[model samples]
Every structure is written in C-alpha cells, then in structure tokens.
Target: MILGWRKRRIARHAGKKNPPGNQEMELVIPNHFRCPISLELMKDPVTLSSGITYDRESIETWLEAGNFTCPVTNSMLRSFDQIPNHTLRKMIQDWCVEKQNYGVERIPTPRTPVTPIEVSEILFDVSASSLDVDQYRCLELVQKIQKWGAESERNRRCIVANGAAAVLAAAFDAFSNDSVERNVAVLEEILSALNWMFPFDVEAQKSLGSRASLGCMIWFLSSKDLSPKQDSIVALKELLACDQKLVEKLSDFEGVNEMLVEFVKKQICPTITKASIMVIFYMVSVAYSSSEKIKLAFVKMGLVSLLLEILVDSEKSICERALGVLCGLCSCKEGREEAQSNALTVPVMVKKILRVSDLATEYSISTISELCKYGRRDEGKILVEALQVGAFQKLLLVIQVGCGDKTKEKATELLKLLNPYRAGLECIESVDFKNLKRSF
Candidate 1:
C-alpha cells in the first residue's frame, strides 16, 4: 500500500491534468535552467571564462555592445572565447520535451558562427570567377556572400572586415560594361550584395563612385524591379555623401537627374523619396563649378515644382530636407524663377516657416528672401504673395519664438520687404502688427 501511495504522490506532483475543455496548467521552469541575462530557459547555453553560463546569443550581444566584463559578476573577462555548455543545453531540451503538453517546444541546435577565414575563402572564389567566362560561378559566389551577410550582424561585420565590399565592388565594376539585359540576374545579385554591405570602407566607397559604378547605378534606378531600384537609390545616397567628386561624375550620366526627380514625383516609398532628394541636394551643393550645371539641370527638370508639391504634405524630416534643397536651388536665377512660378511656392514657404523646425523655418525664409531679393520681374508680386499668405504673421511668430541669428536676420529682412505691403492687404489686421516690439 505504501509503494502505491508513493506512486500516486509522484503523479500528482508532476502536473495536475486538466479536464476536457479546460486550460492547461502553466509549466514551472527551474531557476538554475534559466539564463541570467535573458531570465528565460536557456537554449544554447555557453560558459564564459568567468565561470558563468549564459545563452549564446545573450552573451554575444553583451560582448558586441562593448561590454568586456561579465554581465552578472562585473569582473573582467580573461578570454573572449565562449565554450558551449552542451550538458546544460541537453538538460533544457529534455525539460522542454517533457513539458510538451504545456506548449513548450525544444530549441533547435544553433549553427556555428561564421569566421573571418571562411569569409576570405568565399571572397577569393568571387575574385577568381569572371562574369564573362564563368557567369554561373560568379552568381553563386555573390549570392553566398549575400546569404552570409543576411544571417547575422556578426557575419556581416566578418564579411566586411575581410574586404568583401571592395571585392564585390570590383566585381561590379568589371561587369558594368556588359549588356544589363542579358546579365540582369547577375547584375541584380551583385547590386543586392553590395547594397547589403553599406557603410562601406573608404576604398569600397571610392570604387562605388567610379564612372562605371555610377552608370550602373543609373541603369538600376531606371529598372522595372522596385527592389533593385530602392537598393540602388539608397546606395547612391551613401556614395554621394562620402565622395564629393562623385557629384560631378553623376551629373554626366544621361537622364540621371530626370530619374531622380521622377522618383520623388512618383513617391515610390518614403525611404527612396528621401534618398533621391538627398542625392539631388548633394549633386547641386557641390563646391565645384559643376554644381552650377547640375543645379540648372535640376531646375530645368521641374525640381522646384516637385519640391513645392512635397512641402505641401510631407512629414517633418522630409520637409526639412526638401526645404534645404529648395534653398540651394533658389540660389540660382532659374531655380528662383521655377520656384516663383509654382503657385505653391510662397504659400508652402509661409506654411513651413516657424512650423516644421528651426532649420525648415530658416530655409523657408531664405528661399523667400532669395525670390524677393533676386527674382527678375516678380519681386513685388512675390512680396505681395508673402503678405497675402499670412507670411507676415508667421514671420512675427518666428521672431517671437526666437530662432538662430541667421534665421532671425532673414526673417527681419523678409519683414522689411513685406512690411510696406502689410498695410495695403486686407489679410493684415492692425492686431497683427500690435505685438511688434521693434520696427522691421
């Protein structure tokens, strides 16, 4: 009887079985089986040199975040190596299996982390395969690099550190001259790999900014596939930021500015839109004399109208960038005329002032100042429109809220320009001018 009673007690303690249509009881995990960092059941348990066990991912993350010491003990690590705690992992797996009725599942075995030597071997294969001679082999190797890059941040860093970016860029430059139609698959794959390897090393960036690479990017931008186009624009944005020389070369590409402006006009996606705008901004903002040519090209392409449209209903960040580009474009006579011709220009500029941000306000006021200051035939009309759009009131708000000295100076100048027209317009009430503490 005592033996039977002991068996009953063991069954009762294991878990209480629920009746039909009832919720299952929660499983209680042992504290020792939990990782200290994640406070959850350990999947792939690993031991540090400090004698503490943690989940492999958790420990890797801790170290990756620049924490050299042990998380729980706060002691300096003697070695960076993490030894697998296979024994503990097995125990956790068994426990999970036993709790299968309670919705617990066993963790799959973790894959081995990629090492630098493995990345180097693949890169060597890539360099060996010629796109013209061994197209199949080249595609496979580039795809493998892309796969490894997608697996983990560690893998990406390892791949990049081993100079995968420069190798892939060189491969891309070599294949760039080929007909993109026949080799679209290989070219797209190469672009995908290169795109994944963003924040490239300076050498890699320079290679990307080469003439062949720039031409290749333009072709991708005009491609039917949205994915490659998105990737290409993002890559272009990064390249333009790193290399000023790329600006001049980029303008030389046929229909490049038109493609960039079309991307903005279509509003393909916010990421692509912002990147396209920034590329245009960089192209025109170059200190070199080619910038003037690029600016005129963009203005001829109706960029001012596109920007005015964007300012109508964009978010704060887009507004700021668009306004910045507008400011640059307005520095030239054609850009000022284009902006002045757009019915939305003065009203949008007024709406943006003191509303979006300090920078937006500054750009808005600066663009208006350019039109009013340098515009050929419609200077008075622009000032009158500024007055009509409640720009006068917004300028006062800008001065009252306080802004940078430059912005304030621009606002004061605009006030002086619009002050004469304020009394003539019906929109300007005496109360609007009552708050002024100083003359414009």
Candidate 2:
C-alpha cells in the first residue's frame, strides 16, 4: 500500500506541465512540508517546544537575533532546544525525490549545530598552547577559532561568548614583550582572532588594556607588516574608548605618538587612519595639564603639518578628528607656531569651514582664530589668506545658517578680525553693500 501511494504521488508530479517557452516544470510543494520560519522546504526540520516546526538553520538564526518567542505562534518558548522532526523530514525528502525531473533537488541532512561546550573546548586549547614553546600548535588553535568565527554569525557569537576574546587578549599580553620575529605568526593569528571577535566583552577589554598589551600594540604599530599594524590600532582605539585611564598611561609611553604620526602619514586604509587619529586625539585631549605635554610631543613630531595634509581630502569623520587634534595642539605655544608655519594651515582651515560638519566648521574657525590671535609673525598675512580662500563668505554663511552659540560667537569674532581685510576683496562687496543699506 505504501509503494502504491508513492507511485501515485510521483505520477501526479510527472503530469504537471511546463509553462510556455520554459525548459523546467515548477513543482507544487505541499504547504505543510515547508518551514514556517523560512517558507522553504525544510532540510532539517526541528520542532520547538511551542509546537512550531521550522528549518533548524532558520530558527537558530531567529533565536540568535535575541527573539525568544516562537516566530509564527507568538508564544513564549519554554526551551531553546529544537527536537528534530524525523517524520516531516522523511516526507519532505520523499517529495523532493518524486519531483526530481521538475528541477527539485533532495536536501542533504544538515550537520549538527556547534554547541557552546564545543566552542569552550577550542578556547581551552588556545589558552593551553604556548607560542614560545609550541608556536605551531598555538597558531593552529588560534586559526581554528578564526575559521569557526568566519563560518557563521552563530559560531562567532558562540566563540565570543565562550571567552575567545579574553583568551586571545591574555595571550597577546603574556607575549607582548617578546621579540616580534620569534612570535610574529602566532601574534598575527591571535590578532586576527580578536579582530573577528570585536566589540570585546568587558573582561576582554580589561585584558587588552593592560600595560603589556598596550606595549604589544605599540610594537605592532611599528611593524613592517601593514595587517598587524592596522589590527593593533583598531584594538587600541577600542581600548581607549572603554577605559579613559588608558589614555593617560598611553601618552606616557615613549615614542608612541611618533609611531601614530607615522601611521597616519602612511594612510594605509581609512579604518586604520581614523583609529590612529582618534587615539592621538584622546592622548592629546586628556586632562588639561598633561594634555599640554602630550600636545607638545605630537607637535614636535610634525603633527601639525600631518593634520593639515589629512584635512585636504579626508572623509567627514577623519576630517573632524584631524581638526579636533589640530585644535588641541594649537592650544600650546609650540603647537600654534607649528600650525602657523604650515602653508596649508589657514587655507585648509578656511576651506573646511561650513563644508564638512558643524563640529568640523567650529574646529576650523577656532583654529584660525588661535592663529590670528597668537601668531608672532604674519597675523595680517593669515587674515589675508583667510580672505583669499573665501573664508569670509563661508564664515558669514556659518552665522546666517545658525549654529551653536559658541560656534556662532567664534564666527562673529572671526568676521570682526577679517572685516578690515575685506575692504578691497570682491567677495565681501555684497556684505559691505548690505551693511550700507542697513545703516541708511
């Protein structure tokens, strides 16, 4: 009787006609054979505790996204465990085989999902392996973690939840002072693993913020290879954002500022460039007293010129941060002098005004104001440069369009400074005429 029923079902599928000019026939799949979550033929049908059957992969993804309720039923789930619906699976497979000539392919049995316990064991293997004694094994374990993370979002989250990030951080911290040549491959793998598991948990962040870890990152910043350098800067940026105290300590590290300046000069990639700029900004914009020292150190490294160069064609976020760092550096005497000496300073600042963002506009105006107020030589020339670069008109636009009170105040002051220089310049004639009409 079962064979007869199967043969009749196959004949029914075979009788379906192909649409005109089409080479293949569309199979009419049964509604009950499809997963509620995916609306597709269920390859590995699993019944949830809520009595809902779905494709295992689809439901797992749904649950991973923080939804605990049954998607279709809208009922609370008593358990996350999904029981395999063997009868439904057998039916779906039989249907697909019957419609094989109509472009339907049988689904292969899905592999078992990775468990948290399995991820924990991998992390344990990574922790037990030592780069100094067993570099090959260490690299292998770290690479396995990286491979798992790359396979699926669920696996990455699983690895991270099992403390992969913290383990890699501790490994990096432990070998931070070792020679780069001896542990370069292992270190790079560890960095790759950590990069894959970003937005590190609190424990991971704390581990990455240790003194040895900071030193390790500084060493990577100086590496001849670009990948590790990029990874290191990104990690450092995250650490600084999480732990404000690291900013102060990082500033005290000798040659760190110089390395960061060099990294910006290289401009390997936008992500790395932004990270390096932000790290520098944090170091130079800490507490006021120490900030001055940090600013001086960066200015001495020719950060002023570097910032101006960055401002020329940088994207919005990079431009804002570069301008911010410039503003901080300009607060010190040496920084202001360094900025004023750069030929691009006034024109770049002027061009940036009212162009990138409100914050960028404010920083540009503020930096130019500092130059005009404190420039030992050619304050008039700086004003003249401002006039020539359409600074006067942009500043006027900034005021008319409205901005924060501090920005508006700076614009007003800048306008007053540039007013005397606007006499013969053609750009200001309209403003002067408007003023004359108002006075009358």
Top-TM-score structure, candidate number: 1
How does each model score on lDDT?
Answer: 0.81, 0.79
Top lDDT prediction, candidate number: 1
Off by over 4 Å in 1: 1-27, 100-106, 130-133, 177-183, 399-402, 424-440
For candidate 1, lDDT tens digit of each residue in 374-425?
Answer: 9848988988888887888778777887778988898898888888887877
Model 1 RMSD in angstroms: 6.7
Residue-level lDDT of model 2, residues 1-440, one tens digit each, is 01111113333556765455554334566888877877777888999999989998899889988998999989999999989888899888888887665656788765556679988887777677753446678788887777777766767777787777888887776656555567778888888778777787788887788777787778888888888888999888888877767888787678887788877898878888899999988887677457777888888888899889878888899999999999989878999888877899987898777667779989988899888878848688888878887788877777777688988888898889888878776253243223221211
Clashing pairs in 2: none
Q: Which stretches of candidate 2 lie over 4 Å from their true place?
A: 1-46, 55-68, 83-112, 124-138, 177-183, 288-290, 376-378, 399-402, 426-440
